[model samples]
Target chain A: MKMAEKRPLDDTELDGLFAAARSTGPEPSGDLLARIMGDADAKTAAVTRVSRPEAGRDVVRARPGLLATLLGLIGGWPAAAGLMTATVAGLAIGLATPDTLDDLTGGVLTSVTGYELEDFMPSYGDLLEEG
Target chain B: MALDALTDVSDEALLIAFGNGDAGAARALTLRLTPRVLGFASRMLGGDRAEAEDVAQEAMLRLWKVAGEWRQGEAKVTTWLYRVVSNLCTDRLRKARGVGIDQIPEPEDDAASAETGLQDKARAAALQGALDELPERQRQAVILRHIEGMANPDIAVVMDIGVEAVESLTARGKRALAAKLAGRRVELGYEDG
Candidate 1:
């Protein structure tokens, strides 16, 4: 009767069996992981490999080159100021010029007649009106 | 946020962490993962532990390579790992011209041989030999369910098969295992008194 005792398979038994089996496989350690990850990191190095100056890496650039400084200035406030000044100066000159309404209309007449601007200025519209 | 919150996080989310150089997440994914992958490979390769290790390791290396493209919230990481390992195993088996373990080569040696004086080792070896004789899917299914203690749905996910398929494999595998173990029932503690 003792030999015939029934023992049902339980979750714990199954886990025990499996855990025992799991012990058969190799265990990957931290160093193994580091090797794999390091190999991956090497791939990143292949893409962009540059070496900056180690001596002054933390310091501000000692002396910006003349061309580099010029380019920087051109790309910075000086260029913006130059552009605004040019625009404002051009507008002021246009406003102060003694050129009349006829002078402004001359180019339009020249395009319409295929005539040169010098040849068909103030006299041209007057001649046309009379004719 | 805690790791439990990350249970909701998709495989792709874990992969995205890996891509962003999150070494902790990478380590977690590896430790929590490689065993399952190794288990699958080992089953398919018919207990050729070395080849299985290679397959699992290469599969993981490929995962790292594709980390850049892994989209978070897209697919389960384990599924992708399974498919990769499966393909690798298939490729290796195909090239080797022998489906090593499934073809029971004349019942080789004393499966319970004790070159070492360990009864547990002998039993484990005998169990492994029996497992080696099982058909590919049966072995895989059984190893996943009975041996690895994986849930049916997760096994389905890892095997890239439906739940019904998983159920069928497990049932058939268990039946085959029972048949195979009938002779060694005393050893497996399943003897009829």
Candidate 2:
């Protein structure tokens, strides 16, 4: 005997068939769930482990190293350069002051007395003869 | 707070989170998607429970691998999954070389009245036996549209066909199913109703 119609059934008949088919479908087993969840956890853990080092790198960069700490203490590179320049300028001024003042005085004395300091002072030869 | 917030997140967002190493999102997605995949695979593979489980696992594995590259708005997660299950089922069917309901084992169900449950099983089995007789595309269309209760457009996405084409395939499939099952109507208890 024929099992089905020569024509397809209408919507209502179709719904009944669909419902029967849906009800009879198999469910996922407990072992299947365990296996899938196990796989998901493994993958997630692998991703977590892979990301930890990157987070570690960010932490490492955040904390200053010895050279960075030293530079920071000196108020950075610009301040260090400025300090070096000021120290050198002070040393140069200090070393040149006496010579500059002596030159100025000798010139003035020579103009007023018509002689330099050397003219008023005994020569090395006169000192040797007296001795 | 974060878990609560994640509970309302869309599947697309959950996948992005999973890609970014959020274990909670991964768990949420597994819970949401795996059963659907198994059910669809079980139906498509003609109720071979073990093979269905394998296909579901493999499809989910692919989803996890591609989560990093899954473009939102390109396709819905459910859409992509149905397509994947369809392709996997097609591949298995091809490899099985025309194996039909003769190879289909009885489904195991535990939560129904004895008389009604046996009748439902018999009806479902008869329908499955008829479904195995249709062309693969028609079978896929019929299963997605009728048994799975998907919209025509979504079925189109899964089948990679136009909505019109999906309509045509499912129409033809249902006709074939009706013809095959027409003889069993009385025996299957649809005659009284």
Candidate 3:
């Protein structure tokens, strides 16, 4: 003879099982918690290290010296060299009294005043007389 | 901030704080999430406590790594963690295929001497045994919906399926469970309705 068939559990009974499962859910062990927390600590430390500014590395450099500042203001070494060349050339031309420059001026001062360029400059005696 | 002080703070906020290097937030998040992760992993792995613990630890480690990039209000922290644990358990389950449902371990008895308590434990164990027989997706959907008490939409997010699909999976899963457990009803203290 065939045995009687069993019926499937109803929703209420199944829910009871689910509720039991929920109530009996496992609690994490202290060792598991420690391992997870250790990972968190290590990860946090790594992130902190990445975000932290390193000492002595990110500091603004010392301010430029006065002469260096002046040099920079004049447009760096190339411009400074150009200015120096122009100044020295002017000084040499004035000291040497280049005839070419006198010709360029067409000797106009000498002709107009009937005196050389040196004559316009005060001598020691002239200076003493003026004093 | 103190751990106690962080009790009222949201999980997303705690994660952001941890991202910003708050050790308190790390502790808070770890304490808050590990149990849930472990429970889900335990059920997914057929109550393999050791493997569940490993999965829980790895999942939390991934969470810590991602805390720095956790986008607040985009997803709930628990949902994201469930997804991670799901994937990890799936990988392990795939690797350990052919392990019969009989191999599934019974959950530890919590020293419940009372008859009701023992009945509850037996019911829970019986349910776990039936859950072990379902397809992986069905198992996940059922656990997330019934045991974990998650909403269908959130279950969809965790299972990476649409809400309607979650409903179908859970329906089929519960039917399968009911059929599987029908034979054990008398043994598990269930009365016919």
Candidate 4:
């Protein structure tokens, strides 16, 4: 609701107005409750960085696609999204992976790598000749 | 380690135990928090229950991962959770601006009896619509204050704002909310507090 005139309502008055409005509104239940909570939970899960910079920027600012740059070139910084899709995409890709060790199971790094079972067996020619 | 101890313990305590590789503490904390966090997420995202649940689960997982590093008195566990959830919502909601809520399976029957359950469902649906119209900050403030019954100071801390600012936001937000629902009081069938 738009106020036609500049209303100098006290804080208490404003509180009452809001309370009355909200009271009259419906109470959430059933699926809706599930829905809101689900959103909140998903949000919490995804929040990686807890503290933000006071300067209102993350330590790094992501660069958007050329379109964003073009927009910036033509207009100004206002054209850029607060978060660049490229940067978040890159970060997400980065976080999803960690360093891995070489496959010891498939390679000679295994303890048995230097020796072959076949080679350890006495050769038939040597055995027969010795006999 | 015991159920009683875990139940009585604060989230922070359980987290510390989890850090030390206490499986029981991890289970207890997840079970204790999952439902409430799920509920909060559902409400904040305007009936997107499935997405909300996903968000909650992810948030909980992250919380578990960071349990060891958590410092005492940095923030209340629950408040920290709410703040985290809100930020996630902001990110996803922005992405989902034009996207409709994905279709998800709904249970026809649950604990409630049929007739009253139907009525409750209608009421809940109505409430969700009105809530959707609220500004993000107002909706969050309302949910924390009225639904979660958090103190002003705690809300402020979670919101990353001053006490006075919290008061003003809540007040203005609630007034707008009240104005929005002026005529629906009788339908909701609850006396105004």
Candidate 5:
């Protein structure tokens, strides 16, 4: 007796096989996942180091310089500016007393110190005459 | 953010987060992508789990390296990954051409409780054997289309070919597979038509 001829898998049969393959697909082992995550972490760290200068020696450079540190201690630029203005005004008042300031103080500073402004800071002419 | 929280996140977002050194994203991406990558590599490498694992690792390593440069909204993450795996597999296959096909290991068997599970496993194994006999491009096209359930346009992107070409390749590949699997119908639990 002759045997029946074999036939190719139909589309439905092939699709069934594909479905089986999909269902039985290989999973990544824990070791493989660890290795991959390790790579990701390493890569991410490397990229972070490159993109963030604060992570490296640049961090030291990024620190406040001497002037900046002083300014920060004095409460930033606005406070420094105010302090500077007060220092300049005080020096101006001491070097060349404004009549208005003297009036405002009621000459109490000179009276209490027992010295006129010229007594503390003599004119250039006084030095020239002494020479 | 928690890994579970990232379940709804897109692959590109996770990749960008990973690029930014988010450990959570890294874990989420690993859990999500590694299985798919391994499965595709295993099929591409003819069920050599070891080689497939190596390929998947290398491919993912490359993905991590390129994560910083991965432009958003330009390409699909899985598509880009598939392309990378395809190239890596092709390189390995070319280098291993000197090795005989018989040296390739068979697919691993899974424990199945029901007879139907056994039948499915057999069918899958027989299909894998047939696929291994196909030309590399044909095998790739068929696997991407059928097993991976990718659209032709996406397969074209992964393969770097036109849609028409992808269609042609898949058609031809299906024909080749049908011919190759013709004799195994009964053995694979299929009734002769």
Candidate 6:
């Protein structure tokens, strides 16, 4: 089909046409904005979480408990050695005097309850004196 | 206070801030960019409001995804966004079957005097009808150059064409629009020559 003659719009007319079109330009709806912002928030949250290990590490200082603090104060292998030493010493003492542990247990129970122990019970002070 | 701070930041800076988890920056960028995208998409999609909205949102979504990796100095942010909107509108237009312009509702404007506003709407509708009849590239070039008032170089970037090509398309587009609208001048409230 033969095309019609192209009659160019005058600049003034073009301006009027454009002005009318510009005035009629669509505004982004509130629903659309909310949806886009929601997507942004989600993606931002994802990026933040992924990067948290590096940036957030300093902000998140983990507090150790009391036992952990004490253990840390003594430091690494020395704490373990100290615990082993105490355990060995107690075992040696118990083997040397088998009744010592039993006597101490009974004497502590009798003192606390004010219940007299039988003749077999020995006080901590008496054992010390004997040793 | 922070929102205030972000208000003056450049669009690139705002996107970077948004990538770093600033809600204020996202709001600022959204306010700055969405309307332009919506307007461009609407014009490109032949006044299809719903499709234009979808295109705008999708384009913005792509922008957010790439914000952290958006290389500054590579491209202008607005240029990049316009390009995205252009591509998205193209994709939808290719896939869409038949469209009804009558389905498009008139804009709500409570601020203007009723008669003037109605006339304005009629003129706008007439222009859009003329625009829809143009080829896609011509329509885009004309809208960007005329209605959006973008510079030729910027229009070239958005349309992915040479600046000379941009000028040619716009000139032809204007001529066609004028030919189409010549009969409606009186109805559009234009005085007779």
The alpha-carbon lDDT assigned to residue B82 of candidate 3 equals: 96
Model 2 per-residue lDDT tens digits across residues B1-193: 2556667789999988888777788778877788788878887887788889999998888888788677878988988999999999989988998565566676666676788777777778777777778998999999988887889999998999999999999999988887777656676677533
DockQ of 3: 0.54
Judged by TM-score relative to the true structure, which candidate is superior, 1 or 2?
A: 2
Task: Give TM-score values for chain A, per-prediction.
Answer: 0.27, 0.40, 0.40, 0.20, 0.40, 0.36
TM agreement with the true structure for every prediction? 0.57, 0.70, 0.74, 0.55, 0.76, 0.70
The ten-residue window of minimal lDDT in model 1 chain B covers: B104-113
Docking class of 3: medium
Model 5 complex DockQ against the native: 0.54
lDDT of each: 0.65, 0.80, 0.88, 0.63, 0.89, 0.82
Model 3 RMSD vs true structure: 13.1
Tens-digit per-residue lDDT, B43-64, candidate 5: 9998999999999999899988
Better of 3 and 5 by TM-score: 5
For candidate 4, lDDT tens digit of each residue in A1-131? 97443333344443443343333333334454344334434434443334335224643566577876787775755535544666787687557543232252343333455776767887588778989
Query: What interface root-mean-square deviation (Å) does model 6 yield?
Result: 2.0
The worst-scoring run of ten residues by lDDT in candidate 1 chain A lies at: A46-55
Total backbone clashes of candidate 5, pairs 3 or more residues apart or in separate chains: 0
Ranking by lDDT: 5, 3, 6, 2, 1, 4
* Lowest lDDT 10-residue stretch of candidate 2 chain B: B184-193
User: What local lDDT does model 4 show for residue B88?
Assistant: 80
Interface RMSD of each: 4.5, 2.4, 1.1, 9.6, 1.1, 2.0
B60 in model 4: Cα distance from truth in Å?
0.5
Cα lDDT tens digits for candidate 3, B21-45: 8888988888888888999999999
Q: Tell me the deviation in Å of residue B98 in model 3.
A: 2.0
lDDT tens readout by residue for model 1, B81-145: 87788789878877876644555232223243454324445445565776767776777777878
Task: Give the range where candidate 4 chain B is weakest over 10 consecutive residues by summed lDDT.
Answer: B101-110
B136-192 per-residue lDDT for model 4 (tens digits): 888888777766668999999878999888888877766765566555544544443
